[model samples]
Target: MNRFNWTYIDHKNERHHVGLMHGAQSGNLLVYCNTDILIIDFQVLHSHTYSFFIEEEFCELSIEKTADEQYLYSFDLNTEADTPLNRYRKKLSKKHLWQSLAFLAGFLILVFSLTISFTYWNKYNNQHQFAYGNGIQGRETIAQISIDPESEGKLVSYYFVANGKSYRANTKFKENATPFFKHGMPLIAGDEFVVKYAIDDPTINEIDYNRPSRKQISTYRNRAIERHLAFHPELDLDYCSCVADIAFKMKGINGLADLYFQRVSEEENPKHNINSYKRLVRSPKFTQRVEEKCWAQ
Candidate 1:
């Protein structure tokens, strides 16, 4: 207050309070004069710097003299000599940088997550799931074995011939096992049984293990698919079916449409299953020649 008695106020006047560094004091406060206020310096303390509001007829007030450059360093409380606002500016700068970096990282992770989800989701939704061939086709043979009179023909230990190989599958049914047997028995020795297996893991062959029930066949086939895929990690059901068809043809099936399922264990032969299919591509007719000179003795 220049006139300590009265401080000036005008109609076109406004003030900005910058800091109140008075530690717990009620009346002590610091204010920043707006630059819009055309304040005039009371004396040639240096050049025009800042002026306080005086309420008198505008009497001049005296201040210490200093060089012009020194005046830039220090000023009356009305000038920009406050410290807290500068600290606030610095904090705002740091906050802005942190927010920007966080946004960038979150955006990149979102993009990657969407890309991965889309890829797997597409695979799951659009997977090839068609079962090839309407049914089994092949030659028929009557593999006969003596059965208990009460058990009927289902007791016959059957031998099925497929892919130029005769498979002796146990179809012997007992009177005690009859109720379940007649329903689940393979057509006997040398009888062409219709079987389906994953061409991926040919060892997972299914040949009417529980006959007259298609449900069992599907259940076992699904299990086989899971087990084969666990080890193979390649060759899905569609691929396996195609390969099985090729192997069936290579071994010279009697009927292309109705060959029986022969649950044969996959041996290390690697000559008649999916491996053989792959081998055939690498070296043509290898499977054909082996089959032509076949001996499943």
Candidate 2:
């Protein structure tokens, strides 16, 4: 017999006493109370131990082991088995927790890969529209610059003419050229710029800023003045003549004048990317920009 305090309540009555229990050979329990004998069959009964205390009114009466190492029970005659919500919390050991984390990480990676693929496809579609569209050949011209309505002032698109028809298209500026990579060429209203375009599809075009006008060249010279002075303060070279020649001759290859002055400053410091003079001699554009724009001075 397992001994523990037992409480029972009937309508308008309460009783408290010891409970005695005995198991029979047939796997049934005989519980003896003050005035009643209750028989429970092991085959038909489900039991659980309460690791936490539960209120008598809400408790699921299951045969339980108390902290004192005694077997006891609360009898709920209405229910035979535990409901899902009342069942014990399934233990999640560290190994299982790690497995769950790994699954979540893999799911996030899949989502990120899909997002990137979609974004790349979207950009490619835009690029294809501009690259393969048809346009009439026209003399080099300066495109009128306007704020892109779709992107606000954050970006600008160019409007040009081909075959006497006006067309609009956005040009792809190099990354980090300004705030947004799509900011287009930073050309002014009257700045000399040109593009190849399809007559039927003006949005499909290629812009060329290689041949700037005299005003544009002057602007470039002014902008580069501070930089040139910072690098070669004592030098007496004219900024416009130095940079415009290199820009038109080299099609705006970067670091030309800087590298030239760098060599002049320290001849022993080996030449930069432009190591071969023969390469420049072979370029007709180089001779043309120099003869027409630079050495004419």
Candidate 3:
């Protein structure tokens, strides 16, 4: 339940106090203008607008549901007839609306320009090794290759050791141009690859996938299973292994890695990863396969 209060000055130079009480879960609403009860509806499950009269002035009260399942209450006074005050308020409202839209458009354009400039700058820095000739060649291991479910983009995480310190970084590419696909071979975890980084700031680096690793895939599936269980401690090892095996067979190692570690924050949406995993495990094909392979007595 939440309560909101505000003050309104009417055309008659009279001051009125407006108030609203809303029950978020119970779907109840109550509106007040001054000492008078304007609207009372105990079954407001959705957004609605109410029309009424305050003295000779027409008024409208709107109740809207927001994205986070909260209610927003708004009141507009003397909007129906073209009275002097109504016309003035209409002009003022239009002025404010236009000002707000203009501000938003300008802000978005500025952001777009900054983003484009920064992207080009970063690309140039990486290409030219920050304009410093102190860049040294380093070997980075393929820690993980994750595929985004929505965009089908590949994110590759790798790490390199410099001056006895390990630095981890990730890069993104479209599904077609993944760095993991090299010389008609799909690279996996534990395979070492080539990268170039600045000697002063090793973090400023880029992948050089033209030089592929000689090492083969090693324990990639096992590592994915371990990571999945680490993230979802509520699940048993047996269940995790079962799901990992099924996902690998169905979608291969990249899909399995994405399912296990696609970087969803637990603090943001605690149940997001588990909920997606549950949906997959509950699917008919997954359920049948798990029962046949994992649950066999």
The candidate that wins on TM-score is 3
Per-residue alpha-carbon lDDT of model 1 for 194-278, expressed as tens digits?
4543333222234543332334334334433444444455656554444334433454331111112222223622222344334
Global lDDT of each candidate: 0.38, 0.48, 0.67
- What TM value does model 1 have? 0.24
Q: Which ranges in model 3 have alpha carbons more than 4 Å from their true place?
A: 1-86, 93-97, 108-112, 123-125, 128-155, 163-166, 169-185, 210-297
Tens digit per residue, CA lDDT, model 3, 1-297 = 878887877667988888888888887888888889988888786899988777667777888888887777888874757766677788999999999999999999999999999998876766575534445444344332344446435554677777678777766655546433422224454456666666656776666554544332235556667877887899788887877878767655544545554455555334334454566667898889988887773
Q: Which residue runs of candidate 1 sit more than 4 Å off their true CA positions? A: 1-82, 128-297
User: How would the candidate models be sorted by TM-score, starting from the highest?
Assistant: 3, 2, 1
lDDT of 3 at 97: 100
Q: Alpha carbon lDDT of residue 159, candidate 2? A: 80
Put down candidate 2 lDDT per residue, 147-218, tens digits, no spaces.
554664436566877668777766443222432111112344444455665444445457756655566555
Taking the candidates one at a time, how many backbone clashes does each contain? 22, 5, 0
TM-scores, one per candidate: 0.24, 0.30, 0.31
When superposed on Cα atoms, how far off is each prediction in RMSD?
22.2, 15.3, 28.5
Better of 2 and 3 by lDDT: 3
